[model samples]
Structures are given as structure tokens and as C-alpha cells.
Target chain A: MATKIDEEQLMNDMLCRVKAVNNMPHDIRATLLDFKVDGYKVGKVRPGIAEMLCNMKTSVFELKQEDDSKKKSYLTLTSDAGTSSEERTKAVGTVMNQLRDEGFVKGWRDELFPVSENFYSPPVFLMERAAVTVLGVLEYGVHINGIVQESRQDEPKMWIGRRSATKSKFPGMLDHIVAGGQPSGISLIDNVVKECEEEAGIEESIVRAGVQSVGAISYENWDPKSDKLTRAVQFTYDLYLPPDFEPKPVDGEVQGFMLWTMDQVKESMAMDYADPIKPNCYVVIIDYLIRTGQISPDSNGFLDILRELRSGDCQ
Target chain B: MATKIDEEQLMNDMLCRVKAVNNMPHDIRATLLDFKVDGYKVGKVRPGIAEMLCNMKTSVFELKQEDDSKKKSYLTLTSDAGTSSEERTKAVGTVMNQLRDEGFVKGWRDELFPVSENFYSPPVFLMERAAVTVLGVLEYGVHINGIVQESRQDEPKMWIGRRSATKSKFPGMLDHIVAGGQPSGISLIDNVVKECEEEAGIEESIVRAGVQSVGAISYENWDPKSDKLTRAVQFTYDLYLPPDFEPKPVDGEVQGFMLWTMDQVKESMAMDYADPIKPNCYVVIIDYLIRTGQISPDSNGFLDILRELRSGDCQ
Candidate 1:
């Protein structure tokens, strides 16, 4: 018989991956460059940007001495540079170009992500999504998982995919059927449909008919490798597939797809408690499991899992 | 034309009531008496107890000198006292009796609540449920709401209760059909069934047949009146009632019951944004609304609500 899974251990493992960034060392905290327009914070530059600017001797920005002890010293654009959204976007673009030249940011993408006072508000400016993390700006992502259940089945199975080995992040790890960041200018539903077609070869008609928005999970963590404070909110969706349907990877991004019973999925999650599932994807799965009653209230660590899944808000 | 409900405002109202206690002032924090056994913290005493012990000249506990900067100074039992679960319980019982005599606790309850390292673990000891909040220990509550939906109805209605004005806490506020804290030794399902029968006069068989555990919501707050840091986790359940079924208030705790459409519930929640529903009941309803798709993912403040509902984790 398989050893019983320790619910507390599983929950701790999941939370360790998504721990919130509430306390930062003064040195690490000092390196962040806050970008403000009209006294409102819109974005931030990742740590080590001060050194880069010093080496380049850029006259585009200057550090403002912070009078408030609580506020970190931030770089402000020169008065000659306008503070309009377009002007600020252009200034950030120039900074990104300089950073790229210095080999800080790799393979820059043109796709823009929103910089808003709050996640639900309208964007003040659209910065390149690829560069937003390097800037330590909060980003939003959308993930849709196909819960394909056969007719008359008591327990529903799910369609899961493994990322292609060639993928830059979390290669060979398990992922949802369709997942992508919420780049600026694209509606969430439109993005979901596009991801479904490109990543899993699911027809647009099937996806549109079956997709249902379940909920979202938010988490903020300090990415050690990039030295950036990554704040993200993932909109989760459930697409119910018909019994005869199977997902095939059209794009090379997904290596393979498999339908696993809920038990098998639980076992996979248990077995890979250390590092198999993508960190954010693990949170989505845990949310789905708790919502669907696969993880009963009586289960140990059920409350802990519920609390940790939304650790982002605390930050 | 019906006015559009301000979703963001409604969510903010709900969140404000359940805001987690993040920072405690030193004066307030100094009052809590920690209870530990074998170096593991099991429970805590509320503020003002130090004065009571001092006035009473109690020899039960002595304040330990702090050596580690990170560790909070705590009150440990005198060396004469035993550290066994039974002995510690008895010792706390003496403290409770002394407190009751001094009017620190009112209306002593026989129902014992679990004292655990965390919400999910087995209890180290059982203390009176009514005194759990007064003791500043984390407590768990269960809330089962009856979702009575008519066949072919697009919007399902819920059975809601108005608490009796004569009741002590949250008197005359709107509440779920059935809700109660988890007392030691009682199973969750058993508590759900018992609460249904007592609170709503629902037959036990019907509840057992239709009740399903949906998910849970957690929140922590510092209760100023009790001068205690209160942490709570609510296990939510949905009981699908027949369309024609009506809940009758069998117990005097509830003044009356009414079935309202989902839109009406939303309107009530929006109208009484400040203090209409019982604070914890509002959280359960929000969870229900989001899960049922009544609160669409595209709705304003939807993600913020998701984040705030689980804010208890970071505490």
C-alpha cells in the first residue's frame, strides 16, 4: 500500500514555494527604484538598476531623497521629461533599452503589461510584459485547466500537460492545459481561447462552449534569481471537455497530454511534493481540489492550504 | 432600471470586517500570556490578566525573562504544576474559575474547544468554547447555508435567517440558516446536522442527503473589547434544499427565516454594506457567490475579494 500522504507536509511544501515578501532587508529594499506619476506609484525598477545607471551615467533619472522614514528613496525623471503616460512609457522604454544593451534583460518582447495603482483599476501605462518582472512590477496571468469528465462518471478526471523540455521555465514539469500572462490589450476570454488553440489544439468553438471562470489565486514572492519582487494574480478557469475529446499539442511548447483520474492527480501531487509541479500551477491545482471536495474539510492541513493559497493579499 | 451594484464597494466592506491583525502595538502585545507544554505553544491568555493575577496574588504562573530577541516573553506555570495535558487543563480550569469569579468571563460554557498548534492538527487540550476567544486562541467555526434552488431557475435563492434581538452576539443581524463553532469531540458532519435541526428545524436525513462541503474562509482580528487577538476559520457547506421547502425557526435564537433570490441577496449585501450581515456570514456568502458564478470573475474587485478572503494565512 502507498504510504499515507501527510497533509501538513504537503501544505507546507506548497506554501514554501509561494511565501509572501513582507519583510525585506534594508539593503535589498533600498535598491528598488519606484516610478511615480502625479504622486501615485505606477511601477518599480528591480534591484541593481542603480549600479547600471551609475556605470552608464544616465541623466534621464535622479534619486529623490525620501523625507518619510517609511518610504524608500526612488529615482524620479528629470523635470524636463513629461510625466504623461506616454512620456513615462517612453522614458521606461529608454531605460529598458539601456539595460538590454548591458545584457541585463534577455530576448526583449514587445508585448505590454498594464501598470495600475491596483490590479482592478485601469492601466496608467503599458510596459513590456517581458520587462515588467525585471522592473519588479506587479503582473497578472490567466490559466485554464480542462476538467474532462466522462458521462455518468462519479469521479471527474482532468487533462494535464507537461511543458516541453525546450521551454525556458519549469521545463518538463506539469502544467495546466492552457496558461499565459494577461498581456495588455487582450481580453481575458480572448487570451483563454488563443492559449487553448495554440497550446493544446482545442478548437475555439469547443473551448468557448465549455469554459467557465472558477476563481483566481494571487501571490507575491521575491524571485531570487532575477532579484525582483514578483506580484502576480492568476485567473483560473475550468473547461469541461466531452468524454470523446483528447488534447493534442499543436505548438511545441507542450510536450504531451494525459488524462488522469483525480486520485492519480493527487498521487502525482503527493509524489512531487518537492518540485515537480510549477509553483503557481500547484496553487491552482490545490484551489481546484479544495473547491471540488477532493480535499475534504476533514483532511489535515485543509485550512492551512486554504489560507496559504492567497498569501499575496497579506503582502 | 435597477441600479448596478457597486461590486468593489461591497467587497471592500466585507474585507474590512474580516481584516487580519498584522501589527500589534507593544502595549497590547505585552498583555497576552502564552501557554506552552514541552516548548510548543498550545494556547494564549487575553490581555488584562496580568493585573488580575497580580491583584489576586496568584502563584500559578511566573513571567519568564526573555533572552532571545525574537522570542516573546511568556508566562509559564510554576514548577510545582505538572505539564501533562490533563494537569495543564486542570490548571487552566482553575484560572478560568478565578477569572469567572472576577467577572473576566461571563456565562461559562460547558462546550470545550480544541487548542492546537494550528487549525488542522489534533488538539493538545480542550478549553471552553466560549472562553476560547477570551483566551486569544485560534478557533474554528462551521457554517452550513441552505441553497434552495427551483428547477429551471437561472438564479438560485438562499434561505437566510435573522438572529433574535434577545441574543447576545450580533443580535438582530442577518445570518446563515445554520452556523456554529466546532466544539471538541464533535465531528464536523454531526455538528452540521445538529445545527440544521436546531436552528432551522430541517430534518437530519435531508441535511445528510444534500449537504456538501464547498470550501473554507479564514480571518483574524484583534477584539478590542476582549483585548484578545482572535483567529477564526469557517468551514462552509451548501445544502441543496427542495424548491418548496421552507426553513422554520425551531430554536429561539433565530427570529425568522426568509428565502431571497440571488439578486436580492446581493442588493441586501450592498445596501447594508456597513453592518447588515453577521461579519463571518458575509464572508461565507461572498465565497458562495464567487463559487456559483453569481460574482463573475470579470466583476470589479473579484480578485481582491479572493485575496482578502484568505488573508489569514500571512498572520
Candidate 2:
């Protein structure tokens, strides 16, 4: 029969067992311990660690000083901190220590934690189809349809689009038309057109026709190593102009209006591109018009001639 | 004194150890073993089995069969695999039986096996940079400076370009006019101008007088997991032209050639308009040129017709 281990002794014994089971060398074990403690102080642990510990065949509880008394609670290895290796290491230590010191190791052997279920395992043949993901952009234009005579103002005002409140990702800035991907026969163009109408409050079914322009942009953000700011096969399409293109701003998302010509709109876009005005909107719309020759290439073009002028040779 | 383990017994003991160490229950161990034996065997089996055995700390060696008196081999797990409960179960019947029958388990224990080195340690923070990995074509266009006489069919054609290959990731495409990227820069235009003359063998002293076009396109055959593709921001410029500009195409990468008008090149880009030509090469170049007004809109004003058609009210 094995000697009854005290909580601290049990924890130390389990740690030794963990090292042996994991086949980790002495140096590596020390490194892992240091890494775990430091990671715990800072929040950067993956939630998976808690699940891993919970599944281990050991019952562990942690004691914390509560006022004058010590309160006992089951130990879990989870932190809101970023999921870095250091954080993971700390979580492992905290859980192991709690369970060992509590003398719950034997109890854990009697209880079983939930095991993760396996999803579908596809064969290798479906690799190509599985790899493809789609990305796209819906381009709208502020057309100078006709000059409206303002009842109060002396100047002839051109009808312009109202500013959108949903500038970033919101009900409309970015919305998931479909939470999960459709299986087949999904036309990207039709989907984009539908999404714009739903999110941007575009009423008309003016699909951007013709192959006007194409290009790529890089996107990057920190956090979640597994997450990437990429959706391959992203396409941009300009909206078709409808005769009764009356746009009523969507409630809560879009705020009301501004009337400006091609020049004023361009200038506003130039002033502060990513301003409340949404500069990329202007770039996409202008590019479409220029390519179709609906608008003249404002002398120097959309790419600011003055800047290019400073640089030698156009090529 | 420790009991002497024969070859088969030694292998069986090791398999049992590995199972215990990995915490694989008996049911899972059975499943894994069955799967390894027959569930998947599309390609080479020996190497795959070797890889799996290596993970289990198993030693597979060649032995001489008594019947044939020729070299044969058997596999056995080492003592290092003993720490895991999961590994222990898997090794019980198969290799351990062989080791005991052969009576070579003691000799196997004496043989030194190489240990696996830890190459990948999880990093403290995953700091990764954004990579632009593909090129796209918006549109394609050509400009002509002077009229080509019918009699000058045999006249030596000229092409403007660099003599030697410039430094670029995609050296196979435009050898002299290399593509470069400036991740952090004031403007994409500024970076493009700097790269042009340096890579294309153009004189930097001459200023780019006008703004051309801003088009859009996207990439292809890019994989985020593999990170195999090279990406760079590209700025296409009109090799500064005068009123009486002549045709010229430099050798090496860009060989000498006569300049063609938009009409002559329209057919080539026709593939992009349709799906015949891959979208990137044709559509990207065409869209950029047309958006810039390098080639004026088609005579019929196809864009206007398209807009009118979309606007049902317009005649």
C-alpha cells in the first residue's frame, strides 16, 4: 500500500509523475514551471488548458485567503489573457498544485471528465474544395443623377448619400448574411448584392456589371494565433445605376445627408480618407466611373498627381 | 533483482508502458491499433508504420530467419515508452509476443537508441507580419504615340525596358521591371514610383507629370497555411510619354517591340472580359488602364449603355 500523501506532498508527487509521463527532462520541467507562473500573472492562457486539466485523472482544489478564513474551490486553468505558451505553462502548474495539495488525486481516478467528440473526418480527395474561402466588397456610387432645386437654399443641390453610422463592423458595417457557408451553387455576385441591400439599406437590385477593376489589399491584426485577417477569392463589384435610385438611410445605422459634386466628394475623400466619410467607398465608386468613362479622369487621376509629380518618371 | 525480459516480452512491456503513459484507455488503444493495421493504407506502409513506432519508442530491427537463413526484421518498444498507460496497452500482445519468443529482449535493452530532440518550443508571443501573396489584374490597355506607316512593316521595333534582371521575388515575370513592396510607407504611389526606376532601368530625374488610374484586382493559388507565395505591392506607371513619343522595348526580360494601340490589344484582353483567360493577368491589367483613361472608353460608350440598361426608366 502507498503512503497517504498530504496535499503539498501529493502535489509534488503528481508533478514528478507528470514530468515522468510527459518524458520531459529536468531543465525543461524547470523552464515549464517558470513559464507557467509568469503566464498566470499576466492573462495569456488558452482555454484548452482548463479542459485538459479537468480531464486529467485527478481531483484538485485550490485554497484562497478569504478575509480571515481560507475558501476552497476547484482549480481550473483558464485566463482571459492571450493564449501564449507561458500562460499555458502557468495554468498547468496552478492546476497540478491545487489538485495535489488537496489530496484529490485518488478521487479523480474514480470520476471521468467529458471527452471531446470528433467531427467528420474527410478523406484527402476533398482537400482542394475544403481549402477555398471567399472574400468580397460591395461598391456603391454617389451618382449626380440630377440637380434638385432646394426650396430654401439658393444653390442647386445634388442628391448625395446620407452618411452611415455603421462605419465599422456593426449591424451593417459588417454582417453575416449566412452564419455558415452554403454548400453549392452559391453565386458570389448575387450574395454580395443581397448583403449590400440588407446591410447598407440599398433598395434597388443594381448589381455592379462589367469587369471594371481588380486588386488586392493586405489585412493584419494581433491576437488569436489561429485567426487570420484573410478570406481568399475576394471580389469587388460596382453597383448598377437604377432610374429611381432613391436611398433612404437605414434606421440607426445611417445618419442623414450631404449634397456634393464629383469634385467636392473627391476632395472630402482626399481630406481624410478613412474619416466618417469612408474613403474606400469613394475610391471604389470613382474607379468604376473612370473605368467606364462615366466620369473624366480628373486631370491627374484619383492617385493624386502632385504626389506622383514629385517622384521622377511616371513608370 | 529485476526479471530478465526476452525480446518479445520486452516489446510487450514497452507497448504497455506507452499506453499507460499516454493515458489511452483499452478501447481507444484497440481502435488505434486496428486503424494503424488496415484502416488507411493508400501509400507506403512501412515508413508510416515506422513513424508511428518511433513515437512509441519502439525499436524495429532486422533479424535472420532460421528457415531461410536470410536477414529479417522485427519491431519492439523500448523501456522509455513505459511511463504512459495508453502506450502500455497497445504494446501488450503484438511486439512483446515477438520479443519473448525471440529471447532478444535483454539484448534490446542493452542497445542504445537515439532520443528525439525538441525542436519546436511554443513562443511567448506569436508576433506575425502580414504577407501579401498574390497579384491580380483589373484591366489591360495599350497606348500608341505615333502612326505606323504600312510600308514600315520591316522597320526595327523598339521596346523600353531594363537590360538586366532586377531584384524581385517574381523574377520570372518581369525580369528587368522587378516588383517590390513597401509594407510601411507614406503612400502606395510613392513606393511604386521609387521601385519603378530602380527596377525598370528608367531615369528618376524626369518627373511623373500626371495621375493615371486606380484599379482593383485580386490574387490566386495562395495558401495561408503553407505561406508559399510571395506578395508585393505593385504600381504600374505610364513610361513618361511626350507628344511625339516613339516605340521602344528594352532587351533582357523586356525585349524590343513596337507599341500597340488599345484597339490592337483589345482582343488579347477579351479573354479577361470573359473567363477564357485567367482573371489575374488579364482583368487586373485591363482594369487599371481603362480606369486611368490610358485608352478612352469604347466608341459605343458601352458603359453608358450598360448604365442605361440597368436604369429601366432610361431610354
- Candidate 1 lDDT over B1-315, as tens digits, reads 236767777666545544433334455555666755455565566536544443455445655655677666665566545666677667666777777787877778777667777765676666676676555677777997788764322467788899999887888988998898887667787889998999899999889767878888766566676675666777889888877778888889898988877766776665444546776777788788777667766666666677666655423
Give the TM-score between model 2's chain B and the true chain B: 0.32
DockQ of each: 0.47, 0.03
User: How would you encode candidate 1's per-residue C-alpha lDDT over A1-315 as one tens digit per residue?
Assistant: 245666666655544544432224455655667755556576566536544543455445656756687666765566644667687677767777777787767767777667877666777667776676665677777888788754322577888899999887778888888898886666777889899999999999999778777778776565667675666778888888877888998889999888877766665665444535676777787778777666768766666566556545522
RMSD of each: 4.4, 27.9
Models 1 onward score TM values of 0.83, 0.27
Evaluate model 1: give its TM-score.
Answer: 0.83
Candidates' C-alpha lDDT: 0.70, 0.28
Q: Positional deviation of A136 in candidate 1, in angstroms? A: 1.6
Among all windows of 10 consecutive residues in model 1 chain B, the one with the lowest summed lDDT is B17-26
By DockQ, the best candidate is: 1
